[model samples]
Target: MGKIIFYEDRNFQGRSYECSSECSDLTSFFHRCNSIRVESGNWILYENPNYRGHQYYLSKGEYPDFQQWMGFNDSIRSCRISPQHQGSFRIKVYEREDFRGQMMEFTEDCPNVYERFRYHDIHSCHVLDGYWMFYEEPNYRGHQYYLRPEEYKRYTDWGAMNPKIGSFRRLHYFQ
Candidate 1:
């Protein structure tokens, strides 16, 4: 099992909560999350309750401040541990919504989509094998989306702020 601790203040001070599973509403434990410590497994932290709003994907690491996770503010209301994906990591990106237009399938991680696929906007995607993180900018920077073994027929279907995607990385499983 994974262990995650949420702190109400930066540097892991103040009230805190330890979670090993999905939490829809973390407000009952703490008013705000200024810091976090991920001892095991990869997780997705949401800015609002019910897994809505901006999200930050974190692995087994330490985040002494909210900015370390690229959070806009100290409002972290929910979190979910990503399940370990078995076998190989495979994904398909489409240039149009509903999995239409030119497509590219990848088993290895793509740091810059333009360098390889030459696609600027990923309107849809299909995660066929493993978990992956899509970035809004090149070199694995900017907004991110954690995709599992599922199908995202549209950009909005995957909770992306826009259809423009520049890079992607396969999630590393914690053993």
Candidate 2:
């Protein structure tokens, strides 16, 4: 898992988020995430669930008080140039006018590669080694979705879990 930098504007707040290499494109990151700075465990990640793209882990700040930590996340997440990437490390926030859609490029003058995200408004995305990890925005919230090899396994019935239902489960299990 890693973190991405995100901000709506310069005056806007900026916050770090957790990320997971496990999740990519569709989903990633678990519920109980560990933070290096903030204590973690504030509330559910992502205020809403109208998400698309892959999911990964995202994290930010830690505090003794849950409410306080949440407040801090809320405060910093408002900044523009919200850093959005796919990895297991916190990224730097982008500059204003960066949030064109659901992407954040790496080049300052001209980024060779731009990291795509599910949504810059709140959720973040990261790409690692040809994979993607989706994560909720702001440090305080918890997780909404995740995409990873394991989940793929479950969906495809390759590595055990094979968690599915009905005839589709049998069809996937066979495949």
Candidate 2: regions farther than 4 A off: 1-60, 63-131, 134-142, 149-175
Candidate 1 clashes: the total is 0
Residues 1-175 of candidate 1: C-alpha lDDT, one tens digit per residue:
7889999999999998999999999989999888899999889988889988787898888899989998889998988998887679889999999999999999998989988877789999999998898888899988888788889999987788789888998987775
Q: lDDT per model, in order?
A: 0.89, 0.25
What tens-digit string does per-residue lDDT give for candidate 2 at 1-175?
Answer: 2333223222223333443222222122222222223232211233223332222222444333223323323222111111233333322222222222334422121111122322233222222222222223332132223332222212221111222111100000000
Which 10 successive residues of model 2 have the least lDDT summed?
Answer: 166-175
TM-score of 1: 0.95
The number of clashing residue pairs in model 2 is 60
Listed in order, each prediction's TM-score against the native is 0.95, 0.19
